[model samples]
Target chain A: MPAKELIRLSGLTKTYGQGDAAFQALKGIDLSINVGEFVAVMGHSGSGKSTLMNILGCLDTPTSGVYAYENIEVQKLETNQRSMLRRHALGFIFQGFNLLARTSALENVELPLLYRGLTRGKRHEMAEKALRSVGLPDKLRNKPSELSGGQQQRVAIARAIVTNPITLFADEPTGNLDSSTTHEVMTLLTQLNREKGITILMVTHEDDVASYADRVVCLSDGNILSDTLNNRKNNK
Target chain B: MTWNAFLIALREIRRNLTRAFLTVLGIIIGVASVITMVTLGDGTTKALQQQISSLGSNMLMIRPGMGFGPRSASAGIPNFTMDDVEAIREQIDNISAVAPVSSSQMGTIYMQEARSSSITGTTLEYFSINNWTLAEGRYFSSSEATSGAAVGVIGDTVRKELFNGEDPIGKKIRVGSSVIEVIGLLKAKGQVGMGDQDDCIMVPINTVQRRITGYTSMHNIGTICVSAVEGTDSDKLVADISSLMRQRRNLQPNQDNNFNVFDTRQIADTLSSSTKTMTTLLAAVAGVSLLVGGIGIMNIMLVSVTERTREIGIRLSIGALAREVLLQFLVEAITLSCIGGIVGILLALVICLGLSQLIDIPFAFNIQINMISFIFSATIGVLFGYAPARRASRLDPIDALRHE
Candidate 1:
């Protein structure tokens, strides 16, 4: 299949507050991501990389911009419609590995499907499959507190991808892990991106973390400073 | 979706057992106390009515005064005569029986026992009018009553006090310096609010008028006991008796009644209504506590929203609708209060049973009241839970995610 543009943003600007108190988080920015691409967004603390990901994931809206996701105008969508879009088409992961405390790993993976009104049997089956794919089949009934940090993130990944969403937005998913666990999580992400062709957009500050992606975009002061292709051992 | 929300709510409640209990404590106390108050009130009302009915459901009492107070006794009011009793029995259409009654406190002695008791003087009609029954022997015959014979029937208390459980029938006992032969034993009527009903002696009216007191006057009757036929309206009977007494007393057109007629049913109704009012007032006060309980739930829900901000963010990011989030919290609050309500109802049931037994009143399980209390507590949940649930749903995912 030919490469197709999945997301397009032109002159996107987000302003918080008004008058003298107004703070511009995202300045006039133009960016486009293609289908099946693994893109890494890099920035410092206040570079607004997280804000850009939040917008792309449909968790927020831009103040003044044209945001098109799969030919749908994201900025024009209602809050509920944006939620539906996120429900059916997008998935998210956070650095904290935010799974409900005291809930089993399998139930954590079944949260989104619960919202989708799936039956208990179907949800249990899918959740079990997802946990197995994440290599925590034996940890299905273990609470997040009982799991190691890497295992917890794997459970979060299983939760994010259990619905088979078209795109996955991961914000510093390995920020809380050591070097070995970070490699494990990065390898899992690569496998999901290559084998399943699920588009991935990740945010990171470390070059080693960014190297796993097929392309890299660096933002400074909410504007793209550089966009470059990354040569890796195996590029899809 | 609602069922899922409910299950999530149950899980959350189970997770924080102590906090949930503390949060719903107000509701628990509220519902329990309300039910207890209403149930006990109904029980008391029923007990009172039963006691009154034991006095004779269709019985009426005619006194020689306008009101039953100290003023009437001090005014030297004219007493009713046997003629008035006879006229009422013959004139009234719904009358089942009527008897002229005269009573006095008299000292009675039998062998080694001595007791001060009320000596009631009436005829055979009094037994049927007041629904008294004989436990042993027989009442005085018409020849014995007409000849003013010294014969009487002793109540159960008198029987026990004087005879000491021995058969007192056909025995002689001195009553007010006059020796009378006991012809019957009256059945025991348990002690009630008014007084002990089984601590008196019954003799013939002629026997008391002619021999015991020896003060024979034309107006010797102190009261008239009149019982209406079954299914007769008490108000109409009272009206009929009032007019008959007025005409017999020769009162002018503008004159108020110089006598009083009392209906046992009216007393029962008044007592029942007063207790019902008291029950309603107490339940309303308890309902205020339920309101306070709702406010408590709101306070805890607000804290829960703050404490679980990150969890809410995770859910929001995972495509949970804002409304779905709202429903989860609302269901949680409702579930907490409903659980409290259920436990409260069970607690109230136990309390009512124990108290009824302790206080010697009837135990009445009122389903309407229990259901009302449960539904009210749930309503309280919705009324107070809306604000905090809305706050949770309206939270921005970005800010919520950043919360610790």
Candidate 2:
């Protein structure tokens, strides 16, 4: 089956400030990703990979460009409308497990659903289900500070997938974890992709982490340097 | 204003429990001080007005002085006499009753137990004009006043001093060289002006002129207590009385009259207005503290916003709008100040009632002032809460997220 296009970014250019001090973060970036595809964007510091992710995630807008997602104009939507889209159709995981401190894991997972105007009962039920799927059913009442690094990442993963968005944007999702816990988190992401068919886009500098994605896109100096499909599969 | 925002606001406040409590201290003091001053001032005004009204309504005190207020009684003011009282009684159109009151410290009372008390000599109409009621027995008859009989009505304090709560009616109490029979007890009037209304002895002006004082011609009366007919224009009565005094005193039209006619209502009004001004001034000063309280809340809230920058970023990244973050802090601020307001109201109530009892004045709740204080407190919350909330909302999500 021909893969359906989910996001299209064309001639996207972003510049900070103006005149002498202007810094170009993203220059003429054009890329397309399809439904159910796991793409890992590889870049070093100052490579503008995060800028592309920000534009795609609706966290910020490009200075001059066109960005369309699922036939809807991403650049023209109002701030509230973009917030609504993010609430309904996007999810994010960060390098820093940005869980609200002193809050329980269940409550952390339920935070995003609160903006959707769901009933408290529904929110609790769904949060419980998401935590169980992330293998954190017993850790629902524990706080992030009380959990190990791997368990905390699992809680963060539960929070990311609680809304069931079409695409999951994970920016260095396993960056803060040890090597063994990083494998555990990557295995969870692979299981979610294979089992639920949810699309995933991650940004990382580690080649081992990038190898988990089906395709690797490398960025350097504010532009994409290469895009290639991965051949090796280590589901075991 | 949404339910989630409200819940979030409470969570933030709970997150910094001790800080939140401390931040509201300024507001608490502000509201309490302002409301307490106003409430107590209102009570004092009521108490003062009541005391003035007890002196009798629609009555004027015509003293032999140029000025009318407390500062008017200078030592050199010429005295009015019985003749002037008669002239005013005869000339005024709405004049109901007039009594010539003459006071002298020269006479002292002696009984089984003796104490020095001022003696006042006046006509029987003085009882009616001053609204004095007889606690027991009866005032002296007009014949007793006319014939200069040695009969007297003892005030409450005189009875307490000389009689010690024993019935003194029909008993003899000596005044100077004369042994006067106590015929009546004047009802207690708490206090009025410079002297206790219940501390003086009342006898016939004629008797005082002949016996207690050497002024035998009845030519000098200290003040004339004039009562107008009920519902008469007090201003007109005062004008008529002033004109009659002027004519009797032989003053020309251009001269400031020697005698001052003062209204009880006017005195009460002046006293009450000054108290009101004082209350307003106190409230304004306390209102500055309210502002300071608001500023304190603002300062703390700004720090909290900066401290929670990453949390704000997380909420923004997960579908929260700028206004949602704005609502969080605004609601938090309003909660802080509203708590302060309610607590202030409670504290003011306790302190006001306590002080009123301590100082022996009536305690009254001024609902309007309390409500205004509360509303002002809420307004302070909004006013001071805005800047910090705006700063929080205007933060760039990406930059905030990247903040360590």
Candidate 3:
């Protein structure tokens, strides 16, 4: 009920199996993310970070607990209803830069907008604008294979923000890039967050990657180890 | 949404054009063979029917014994004689003309050329019964018939073979030690009923019996061709001829009549129906290829779904509905088969044309068959395509994303 708590998770539990084979990935975790916040979740391997990210991104259901986005009950929404939420409210970028192969960059960026019922002309215009904003207007017709890794990830970024989603999820987005390219991508994300006021939630293991977020949430063995506002990274 | 799906389908096909073409090959061969068989069969039947119809619907051929077809013979039955022909011509009402016909597969004949051909012996009345119009010269004269004149008329093939386009109106040809002058040259009437009707020569029945073979029984003959005058009932004429033959053969009520009277129209009908049956059988056999082709499409689609699991995951994450993915794959299947159908139709056209010309029958394009094969292939796409498309749509997004 805080002034701008856009996402709230309370007593969230996600287990992998039944009986003796059961693996509880997240154990009664509670977290709140405010509007326009860039939050990075960091943890070691087997620390339940990916499971928690999956739940927060609405890509997976929790075994038990409450998940609400903007006060709407996400845990209770049906599959299609959840799909609708994802379509209208969320955008995702993957570690692999999940661009469709054999498709041009502009077409890849236009993919999300196609489901939003935009006219053909509007879809093209917005896709071109999104590509230009990501600094790839000249490479609009280049396929993923034709572009470098940094450029491909830029196309994926354009795809993510083209629909003007309420929240963006980046899963180890810079993990596949070189150190210099990673800096560029990180700069692009910070620029998008500062200029567009888009709430960003990223999952990463690197301290350098997490250093760009306004806040950091650290998990250890299915439980939150630390949650702290990062004065060093906060742009506002 | 469908338009977007269609575009996706088009892009997918274009991405792997070779695989798409191979996937549709079964349909192409299927439709091509089917159209070829059907078109040629119809052409042959058409040509036969036209030839028989030109022979006149009202004509009946009375032969020895009760026979269903040309080669079938009712054993122990006697052959016909000229007395039967004369009796029918004089006693039967509605009878316009009647002629006794005899034929022999004679040995090689020589004059200007040497060739062996069937020799038909009949009178000028044979012309009227068969409605055979002369192209040149004249028919049999009564004096020539009574005196057994050694004169003949050559059909187109015999003219080509022995005459070599030389005027056969007065030239002489030798037939197994007998010499005959070609007094009339018949016009080109192509193969009718059976083999080449133009290959054989026609002469007076008397000339054949007395001069050629020396079998001089005046009443004995071979086949009788009879025609009815206008305004006569077919059934009545058949009954009149049957009763007359029965009486002439001296068959009691318990005994079987030894002669056969056949309607030309009935033979034409039977021939065409049999051809229709053959066409249906051939088309059905070819239809199985279409089924296999559909299955090929489904198999490839299932493989495609597996191959693109992560791609599908990306689409789902990007907010594509399950049905949209389903529609996209379904469109691809339909597009594949429909293209195959179109190619099959074009291939069939070329094949049918070549075959019709090769077999010397008229090429008949049946629009109904074209429509049926086209729609049937399209339906095959939809029916076999749904299973794989549905499998793609029902894929779990999490698992799909995890799939390598």
What DockQ does each listed candidate score? 0.56, 0.51, 0.48
User: Please, what are the lDDT tens digits per residue for candidate 3 over residues B1-404?
Assistant: 88888877787778768768866776676667677777777787788777876676478888876676654565666778888888998899988888888988886465647778988889888876776667788877889987889998888788778766677788788876788888887777687757787787889998999888778886457688888887778778888999999999899999766777887767777888887887778777766766666566566655665556777778788778877777877887788888888998999999889888888988999888788777776676666666655654565465567775
Query: Of 1 and 2, which scores higher on TM-score?
Result: 2
Error of 2 at B42 (Å): 2.9
Per-residue lDDT of model 2, residues B1-404, tens digit only: 37889988897778668768866776787788778887887788788877887788688899887765775777766788888888888778887899999987644555557677888999988988888999999999989999889899988988888887678899898887778899999889888665687888999999998877767776679889988888999998888888878888889988887778888778777878887897778777877776776677666655665557778788888888888877887788788888988998999999998999998789989888788878877677666666655755566567677765
Clashes of 1: 0
Per-residue lDDT tens digits of candidate 1, residues B50-143? 7777788598999987777765674667889989988998899898889889999999999999999999889998888776899998998999
DockQ of 3: 0.48
- Candidate 1 local distance difference test against the native: 0.87
- Using all chains and alpha carbons, the TM-scores for the candidates as numbered come to 0.81, 0.85, 0.80
Best by TM-score: 2
lDDT of 1 at B367: 97
Residue pairs clashing in model 3 are B82-B219
| Model 2 chain B: worst 10 consecutive residues (lDDT sum) | B105-114
* Reference-based lDDT, residue B75, model 3: 64
